[model samples]
Target: MSEKKKGPYKQTGNIAVDMVAACINHYEKQGRKVAYIRLDFIHWTMFKGYVLEQIPAYDLSNGEIEFDDVIVTQGSSLQVKPLYHELVADGKPKVYLMN
Candidate 1:
């Protein structure tokens, strides 16, 4: 019998960012068409500031920002923590791929 394969996950100081990066990588690898990434727990003001700093061409009117070929949307922290916890419970590594 074959045992289930365990993870060789990634890590970073910000687990949220790491999770996003991982998801992007996964989707990209699968050649999937990603609509957008919703980031929860961040305020609109902060999200706008972050976008301005990270993506100069981002326009808030559209409520979407593309970074490294991935479209992202502002979301709430409450929604994000549970996903992070799921990843952690699955033994995902803490790999940091975001600035």
Candidate 2:
């Protein structure tokens, strides 16, 4: 994790994980890969500093936006109790690193 910065999240068309899955399942007659526009944050905003939401829905058209940077929104506080409970109970909210 480098560092969190201010910005809106955008979709990146990188699915190396899906590709690896395809390769692993290719011999089982699965196709190369299906066309899909997977959506996630290019960078989820770090508020007082934890990734809260994937992408804050904005008033933009086309249901997609080209995001290279972002601005900090209000209400950066997170509900810590539930999140800690989830982590302790089931070990959720996994973290990943992508290029």
lDDT of 2 by residue, 13-77 (tens): 33422322232234224323222222223222222122223344443344322222122222214
Worst-scoring 10-residue span by lDDT in model 2: 80-89
> Cα deviation of 52 in candidate 2 (Å)?
17
Clashes of each: 15, 1
The root-mean-square deviation over C-alpha atoms between each candidate and the true structure, in angstroms, is: 14.3, 16.7
RMSD of 2: 16.7
Judge candidate 1 at residue 70 and give its lDDT. 54
Model 1: per-residue lDDT, tens digit, 1-99? 012124533554355545655775675566564455666655334545655765576566887655445556665545743222111123457688987
Output the number of the TM-score-best candidate: 1
